[model samples]
Target: MPVELTIHQPSEIFLNDAAVKVKAESPAGCFTLLPRHIDMATALVPGILSYETPEGREVFVALIGGILVKQGNSVTVATQMAVEGPLGDLKNAVDVMIREEDDRDRKTRAAVARLEADFVRRFMEFRKNA
Candidate 1:
């Protein structure tokens, strides 16, 4: 019996496939799951998720931190982000995604800081006038 693997992201389903084996990284370390594996759940870290198809071909997906659950022959992964493709391509894609997220976060922080500074300045002016 093979295991059914499904990966979910907030916006879409990342992957749904039947896999002979699956490998993922967690806080404790990396682990592999096979059919009949014990039922458990773990906090997944940002890493590569690899699985073997029934035809014996291996596929890889880059995953951001998330939660993973294995129950019976079903494995479910809920992640914030994932990129799936050839291993080399997937690595590049993941790097780009990480950089983009970092840039967005930096911009958001800068905007918030500016807003805070403006609020403080306005408050000081009001206090002086009063």
Candidate 2:
């Protein structure tokens, strides 16, 4: 029997498939899960998730961070974001994702600063008028 693998994101399900084996990384270390493995849960770090289909095809998914739960031949991964591709390509994809995330953080900080400056300027104007 194959394990039902489901990868979930905030907006949609990233992947739903059947796999003979699945591997993931956590803060403690890397581990592999088989269909008859004992039930467990792990907190996944930013890393690659790989699995082997019943037909022997291997696939990989790069995830930021998430929670993985295994119960009765079923594996579920809930992550903020994921990118699926070949291992080499996934490495580049992860690098790009990190850069994009950093850029978004910088932009958010700049926007907050502008809003704060505007609020202070308005407050000073109100004081002068009063």
Candidate 3:
């Protein structure tokens, strides 16, 4: 499937185009939803949202934000206030995300930490088992 996304930055309102949707994290969990999804919404938190364009996942840190995703055959993400990162650095990218979110509220910070930790734990567990 070839699905392209657009993320319109609030500050960059002059640019009225849907920017590419990157892999991202919500309060519920971390996922990469492509276009043509099932139409689901999630609570946005301060964390990292990554977008993998079939080729690979590009991780980015989202500052003070939330997004809604609905993925099935395809997906789309709508977010706010995001800071980008390198090509392949999910962990480092997420680490920065935790600290940045921590600058906001204890609750938001804690939530981001928990989510990031959960992702790490799961990835580790999967690798160990694999």
Candidate 4:
């Protein structure tokens, strides 16, 4: 029997299909899930997630980060972001995504710092006025 695979993102369902095999990367390393695999759950890192369909065609998904659960003949993945495409394209996409995420983080930090500084300045002015 084929394993029912479902991938979910915060905004929408990324994929729902039947897979003969599923491969993903976790903190420990990469692993493949096959039929009759032991039930388990793991935290997935930002990497490529691939699965072989029953017809033996491979599909790839670029994942930012996620949680995966396998039970019986069902596997579910919940990720913050996911993009499905060819293996080569997905690899490059993941690299770009990482860089974009880092840039966003830096900008967010700077904005927070500016907000804190403004708040402190306002508080000091209020004390002086009082």
Candidate 3, 46-113: lDDT as tens digits: 66555555555444544455555455433444555555656456456556766755666788878999
Instruction: Give, for candidate 4, the lowest lDDT window spanning 10 residues.
Output: 96-105
Model 2, span 53-127: residue lDDT tens: 999999999998799999998999999889999999999877777777788889999999999999999999999
User: Mind giving the per-residue lDDT tens digits that candidate 4 earns over 41-112?
Assistant: 999998999999999999999998799999999999999888899888898989987888789899999999
The C-alpha TM-scores of every prediction are 0.80, 0.79, 0.46, 0.86
Q: lDDT of all predictions, in order shown?
A: 0.91, 0.94, 0.56, 0.94
> Stretches of candidate 4 above 4 Å error?
none
Provide the lDDT at 100 for model 1: 77
Higher-scoring candidate on TM-score, 2 or 3: 2
RMSD in Å for model 4: 1.8
Clashes of 1: 0
Better of 2 and 3 by lDDT: 2
How many clashes in each candidate?
0, 0, 17, 0
- For candidate 2, which ten residues in a row score worst on lDDT? 93-102
